[model samples]
Target: MDEVSYPSADVLKLTYVNVNPTNINGIERSGTLYSLIGDELKIANAVPGTRVFVYTVDGTLLTSSTTDTQGCSTLPIAGMSGSVYVVKTSSVTFKIRKL
Candidate 1:
């Protein structure tokens, strides 16, 4: 079966949604946005120096890191099989599907 996808940038943009935007100090920031790039999870629009944590379904810690100045970070998900994991940031906590 063929998979249907967004045919253009405009169509993609129209469907694109930003998650919760967080405000720190006095600045508003787009919170913890992520995209699957091959086996790497690319997170964007986070606060600079925000900490990111990946944990197993049972609450076991997997890995953790901090975002850069541009408010982005990537975590390699290649070593493990796909599963629902909890991703935590300085301002938010959410579930992430690794594929």
Candidate 2:
């Protein structure tokens, strides 16, 4: 009998806002993801603390963090590549791909 092995990675939490020291929450819009390179994932937003999140197109949560006061957040993307990026919110979401 042969055993099947699947590659496993750690699951990370995704954040959409920075620590609301001023308020329990700030202006929220769910979140978005963008392709930084050819089939690559990176942070993309008009400003920091854009309440952005990075994740797998398959709806998998990767490294996540609330956008800094400037709406800047860090996403964990290693050994993963794709032309599509997924964005999600409490109600809606969309994808961003670069050609």
Candidate 3:
């Protein structure tokens, strides 16, 4: 691919997604993600070359882009707030709001 990629912005209108909690089965799953409302992006594990989609809180997919190896992204969410968003990729799968 002869495509050029840009760097991600420092500030972002961050939001979070509540993972469906469980007890007996535990909350561990592969390829799990915490996406933003109205957005199609997974908060963490957003590696470069990964195909992702951005959206709004109203369930509208706003944009599409890929991530960088640093787990940084090359796209921006329009009309976003300056909040901390996080995603857990350890034994427990959850989205932690990091500000």
Candidate 4:
């Protein structure tokens, strides 16, 4: 007797999805890019001198910082762990949670 292996049911149903397709001009586009490392929030690829604001989920303003000439800023988010926050920049707004 011979034994054959087959893909699992879940694997068989897996389909490729282009969540972020290329732009009309065939150039890939990106939105606001940032990252949270430790207790600091780092914003990159933004416009220079842009203001970045951090607020509590309840709309309470926590702190704000301005990007430098390189379009990057790092804001301290100490003491705000385990909670959701709202970060807003000149052109974009997003949510983040500190772990």
Candidate 5:
């Protein structure tokens, strides 16, 4: 048989690391690429006139729109509150939940 030994709690050392907290309230910020305001999905830094599509989680097409001159597209997500959907563009594809 083999015997095992364990370290005592009194001899243990703990290290603390600093962490930067982030905000996840769906607001547009420096690191946040997208934001959802009510039934409108806003994507930052997109190309102007880019085509955007919104689909259900099950791959059902809900709606589509094009970005304006400001590279922002206001998607009409009526009747999709509290539901998750997929948004896709020519350069990016991501999922967003309507609040």
Candidate 6:
């Protein structure tokens, strides 16, 4: 039989290093923004009448819509949870996370 010793608290503890965040997703920032309202994602600062696309992490197009004159568009993403998506416009693309 072999005997083993367990690691101490310090050895088993997790140490987090503060690392600078990066946008490494290859998505450029065109200053378009979005916010969540219930299950809908409301986009802001969009060019009015322009198109917006919602895609899954694998690049599947989930939905597409045009923004209203207020430079905003509300996308109904109800029932979509625990997924990361990419939202794009004619000028930019960025990643969004759903909780």
Best by TM-score: 4
- Residue 9, candidate 4: C-alpha displacement in angstroms: 16
Backbone clash tally for model 6? 0
lDDT preference between candidates 1 and 5, better one: 1
What CA RMSD would you report for each candidate?
Answer: 11.7, 17.3, 20.2, 7.7, 8.0, 6.6
For model 3, what is the error of residue 53's alpha carbon versus the real structure, in angstroms, after optimal superposition? 1.3
**Which regions of candidate 2 deviate over 4 angstroms?**
1-50, 89-92, 96-99
Candidate 4 structure quality by residue, lDDT tens digits, 1-96:
899566686355555586546444442335446999998999888888999999998999999999899889999998999889999876777789
For model 3, residues 16-98, the per-residue Cα lDDT tens digits are 57655553555545443445544334445644455555444344555555556755453444355554333322234233232
- lDDT tens string, model 1, 1-99? 999776686473454375456633443345557777787878898888988888998999888888899989998878756689888776767777866
- Ordered by TM-score, highest first, the candidates read 4, 6, 1, 5, 2, 3
Candidate 2 vs candidate 6, lDDT winner: 6
lDDT of 2 at 87: 61
Give the best candidate by lDDT: 4
Better of 2 and 3 by TM-score: 2
What lDDT does the true structure give each of the candidates? 0.78, 0.52, 0.46, 0.84, 0.74, 0.83
lDDT score of residue 11 within candidate 4 = 58
Q: For residues 1-99, what per-residue lDDT tens digits would candidate 6 score against the true structure?
A: 899566685465655586546836454665678787778988888789979889998989998889999888889988878989998888877788889
Ranking by lDDT: 4, 6, 1, 5, 2, 3
TM-score of 2: 0.37
The candidate with the higher lDDT, 1 or 2, is: 1
Root mean square deviation (Cα) for candidate 1 = 11.7
What TM-score does each of the candidates earn?
Answer: 0.63, 0.37, 0.31, 0.68, 0.60, 0.67
Question: Compared with the true structure, what per-residue lDDT tens digits does model 5 show for residues 1-99?
Answer: 899556776657665576445533443333325677776677666777889899989999999988788877677777888878888877666778767
Show the colliding residue pairs in model 4. none
In model 6, the worst 10-residue window by lDDT is 18-27
lDDT of candidate 5? 0.74
Clashes of each: 0, 10, 6, 0, 0, 0
